[model samples]
Target: MNYDTVRSVDPAVADALEAEVDRQGDTLAMIASENHVSEAVLEAQSSVLTNKYAEGYPGSRYYGGCEHADTVEQLAIDRAKELWGAEYVNVQPHSGSQANMAVYTAMLEPGDKILSLDLTHGGHLSHGHPKNFAGQVYEVENYEVDEESGRIDFDEVRAHAEEFDPDMIVSGFSAYPREVQWEEFQAIADDVDAYHLSDIAHITGLVAAGVHESPVGVADFVTGSTHKTIRAGRGGIVMADEEYGDAIDSAIIPGTQGGPLMHNIAGKAVGFQEALQPHFEEYAEQTLKNAQALADHLQDHGFSLVSGGTDNHLVLVDLRDSHPNVTGKEAEEALEDVGIVLNANTVPGETRSPFVASGIRAGTPALTTRGFDEDACETVGHCIAEVIDNPDDEDVKAEVAEIVTGLCEEFPLYDDDTEGLVFE
Candidate 1:
C-alpha cells in the first residue's frame, strides 16, 4: 500500500501500477477464470514466509529452519481437506497443470491411454492437448460435446472409454457452461477400470460453497487452482483418497517440483478459511444468479449463448449469428475500448483459429464479488451487446465506457478502509 517506496525506487513502474489500478476501478471484468481476492488473502501472499524454502511436507522437511513454515503448510493442507472432504491433500503443486502432471506421474506409465474431453470443445490444455506433456507422454483419446445440447455426451465418453481401455479419465473443463455429470463420469471410469481425476479449477469455490455438486466424493484424484473461483492466491492443489496419498505427495515433491511457495500456501489457507464462512454460500449463489441474468439479457438482445444459457458463473457467446462480420478478437478489442474486459474463445466446431476465435467467453465472478447483482448484470450485458453490435462505432463505445464508469462507482471494490490493505 506504500506507493511512496515503489515510487522512490522506480517512478515509471509506480506510475504504471497506479494506471492499471485506475483502469480496473473504471472497467467491468468478466473473465470467468479470474476473481478478486480478499485483503487477507493478498496479505498472506505478500508475507515474509516467501523467504523460506520448505522442501518437504509439514513436520518432515529435508531442510532446517522450517518449523513455522511447516505449520503454515499444514494449515493449508488441513483447510483444503476440510473444504473438499478429502482424505489427503498436497498443497504444493505450483499450478493446476502441474497438479495434473503430478497425478499422471504418480499413477500412469509412458504410453498409457488416457481419456479426456476434447480441447476444442471445453477441455483445458492440461487435459491432453497435443503439445502438452500429458499428450506427449500418454496415448490420448477425447470425447466431444453433443452438438445439439452443447453438453458432454456421456454415451460418447463411455463408448470411447470402452474402446480405448484408458488407464485414466480426466473430467472437468475450462469453458463449458453447465454442471458436470460426475455420476456418468464415474460409471464410465468404472466400466473401463480407469482412475477418475476431476480438475475443478474453475469451480472450486462453487463446490466449497455448496453451490455446485462436488466430484471430490467420487474421484480418485481431484486437482484445482486456489485462485479462480476459490479467491485464493495464484497456486494449485491436489486432493486424493487416502489410497493414493503417498504416491501423490512423492510425485509433487520429487517428481515435478522442488521447494513449495510457502507464502502462497499461507494465502491458500486464508482463502480456505474465507470459503468456510457462512456467507460464502450466498456469494456463490449470487455468482450463478448474475451469470444467468447476464446470459438471459444477452439472449434477449439477440446474442446466441452456448448451451442456451449458463448454470454457473460463465457464458460462452457464439458471435457467428450475432456479429457475423466481427471476430472474437475484434469484439474483445472493441469491448476493451469501452472499459469491459473478456477473453476470445473457440466455439465448438468453429472454423476460426483460437487466436481469432468465433466466440467470446464472459462471466460474473469478479463483478459479483464487487457486489453487482442481477440489475447491474443486465446493464453490463446491454453494454456488451451494444459494443459487439457496432464494433467500429467510436461514439457508441465512448457512451458505453461512461456507463461502465458509473457502474463501477456504484459497486466500488477495495475503495473504503480496505483500499490499501491489498498490499499489506
Candidate 2:
C-alpha cells in the first residue's frame, strides 16, 4: 500500500494532481453523488492487487497464482451480501451503469419493454435515457414525478406498468430527494409480472447503515456503486435473490465486462467493513440531518426547494421562481467562484436543456463525511443563497469563499493525528 508517490512522470500532470488535492481541501463539495473515502479504502485501492489478472471468480480463475486475489474478491462479495442481506453479490461491474446493463442483458431480450423513471424527473441515464445502451436495446417507457408534489405518484407508475407490461421495472434516482416506496414498486411489478430491479447506487450507504429503507428483500435485483455515499472506490456491485444469482453473475462476467479490477474489490471490502460498524449509522444520520438543515435554511432564505424539502442527503432547488434571472449554469458558476461545488440539474418540468438546467442540485454527504454538521450546513446553505441571489457581486462571492474556507478548516477531511489507522 505505497501511497506516497508525489511526482508524476510528467511535471504538468504532477502539478495538476497536487493542485486538485488543494482544490478538494479548500472547496465545499455539495455534489450529491460524491464523497470522501477513508484512508483505509484509499490504501486498498492503491495496493499491490493492481498487479493481478485474476479473470474469474474465487478458486475458479483462468489464470494462475491468484490465491490472494481470490481472498480479496470473495471478501468483497461476502461483505456486500452481509451488508445488504442479499442472497448473492457480484462485485465485478466497472460502474453502476454497467451493473444495470448486465442485469438487463441477463433477463430481458432486445426490444422487450422496460418501465423506468424519466431521467429529467430524478432518474439516472442508465435507467433508459435515449443515449444509453438500455434505451438502445429495450423499449423504454418512463414514469415521471408529480409536478405539484415533486414526488413519485405510485398510481401513475402503476398505470404505466399496466400499459407497458414491461419485462423489468427499474426503481432509483440520481437527484430525487424523497424516499422511494419500494413496496409500491414491487406490488406494481408483481401486477405486471415484471422483475423489480432497484438501483440504489446513490443511497446504498444510507441503506447499509439502516438510515434508509432497504430494497433487497423486495427487489429481484439491486445494483449500486461502490463510491457515492458508500465512500468507497469507483466500482459497481449487483446483488440478487438466490434464483437469479447464476444468471446475474454470468451476465456481469461474460455479458458486460471482461476482467474485474481486483484492487477496487479490495477497497470495496474495506468500505463494507466500515459500513457494518455502528458508527456508520451515526454518519448516515448526520448526512440526513445536514441535508434537512441545508434545505430548511435555503427555504427560510426564500429559495424554493423542489419537493419542499429532503428526506435524504440531497436537495434540488428550483431556481425558476426563486431567481428567474439566474440560470442553473450561472448559479453553479457563481458557487464555484466561491469554492462551493455543486452541479446544475433539471427540475421536474424543466423548460431548459439538461446542460443548462433550471435548477441546482446540492447535497451534504461529502461535507458531512469531512465532519460538517447541521450548523455548518446552514452556513453553507446561506453561502449558496447569497451567491445565487447576487451572482454578479464579486464582494459577496469573496465573503462566501472566506466563510467556506473557515468551515473546511473546522472540519478537516484527513487528520494528521490518525495517519496509520489500519483495518485489522
Candidate 3:
C-alpha cells in the first residue's frame, strides 16, 4: 500500500500512515475490541462523502445536496436492521459510548439512577464510570460477577437493582467471556420498571451471524460499535422498537451529536453487505472455535482463565493465579515485543490498580479475519505462553518472534501487488 499521494502533500504524515499498515500486517492483533475491516470498507470510509454534512436522518435532512448522504445513511440503517432484526436502527453516533449516551439522553433526566455491571467485572466506562459524562449526570450503582464462578449472578444483579431502584439497567459487557443472558437482564429491568439498554458493542458481528445471542428484540434498547467484531469501520449504532425511534433520533442529533459521519456510514453499508454473505457466518463460528482452542491451549500451559474458558471471541487470563509475580502490564509488554498484541484488563476480583491489573484479555476476531483457524490460534497461544512464562529470556523471545514472522507471512493482510500506503 503506497502513500504516494500523501507523500506528495505531506511526507511526514504519509510515513506514519505507511508505517501503521506495516505494523498491522506484521503483528497479531488479539485485542478483543479490534478487527480489520475489509479493503472495500476502508475505501468507502476514505470516500468524498466525508466532505458532506447530513444534519438529519435520511429524507428529512436540514442541509442541501444530501442526496448521496441520504442514500448511504439509509443503506446503513436498513442493513443494520436486517443484520440484527431490529424494528428501528440509527447508524449515527460517533462511537459505542456516544450511542449509550444518546440512549441515556433520550430516556433519562439528570440525576436519574443507572444500574450496570461493575467496570472491573466486565463493564464499560460509558455505563457510568466516574470520569465519564454518564457518571457525572446519573446516580450509578454497579453489580459484580461471582468471584467464585467468574460469571454474573442474576440474583445478585436483581437484588442490586431492587435496592438501587435505578431508572435504567445496562446489560452486556466488555471483558466478560460467557454468553450474556439478555432475557434475564430484560426480566430484571421489567421487575424493577427500569429501561434496559443492552450494549452489544463487542459482539455485534457474532450476534449478526447468529453465533451469539442478540439483544435487539429482547431489550428496550440496543447499541453497538460498527467496528470490533463487525468490521464496519469506526462508528456506533442504536436500535430499538419503533416506539422509541423518534426519541432516539432526536437525542442523537440535537442532544449528543450534530451531523452524522456520512463516510463511516458508507463503510458500515459496505461492511454490512459483506457480513450478509454466507461466508460471514462461517467466519463468526470459526472465531468462537479459535477462541476456545486458544483457551484450551493456554490452560494446558497452566494459565487460569476467567470463567474457566470462553464462549465468545475472547479469553481473560488471570495472571495472579498462574504467575503471581507477573502483572498484566508486564505480560502485555512482553507479548507485544514478540508481536502478539492484546490488552491488560482488570479481572473479576481485581486487587491491583487498573493500569497494572492481574489479567490479560485476548481475542480471535482479527486473527480469524487474517484466516486463522483453531490450530493456528493454538500455535499463537503457545507462543503467548512461552513469552509470558519466560518474559526475561532473550532466546525465548527470539524464537517466538521468528514464529510470529512466519505466521504473518503465511496469513498476509493485503496482496503484495496492492499499492497505496505501503511501508518500506
RMSD to the true structure for each prediction, in A, is 1.8, 1.8, 2.3
Report the error of model 2 at residue 394, Å.
Answer: 0.5
Question: How do the predictions measure up, each by TM-score?
Answer: 0.97, 0.97, 0.98
User: What is the alpha-carbon lDDT for the whole of candidate 3?
Assistant: 0.93
Off by over 4 Å in 2: 1-8, 415-424
TM-score of 3: 0.98
- Candidate achieving the largest lDDT: 3
Which lDDT tens digits does candidate 2 get at residues 1-424?
1223555356776677667767887888899999988888988998999998988789998899999999988989898888889888999888999999989989999999889999899999999988998898899989999988999999999988888889999999998999998999999999999999999999999998888999998888899999898887789999888889888878877778777899999989988888888778898999999999999999999998889999999999999987988899989999999999999999999999999999999988898888888999999989999999899999998898899889878876555655522322
Q: Candidate 3 lDDT, tens digit per residue, 33-145?
A: 99988778889999999999889888899999999899888888888889999999999989999999999999999999999989999999999999999999999999999
lDDT of each: 0.89, 0.89, 0.93
| Model 1 lDDT per residue over 274-301, tens place | 8888777888999999999999999999
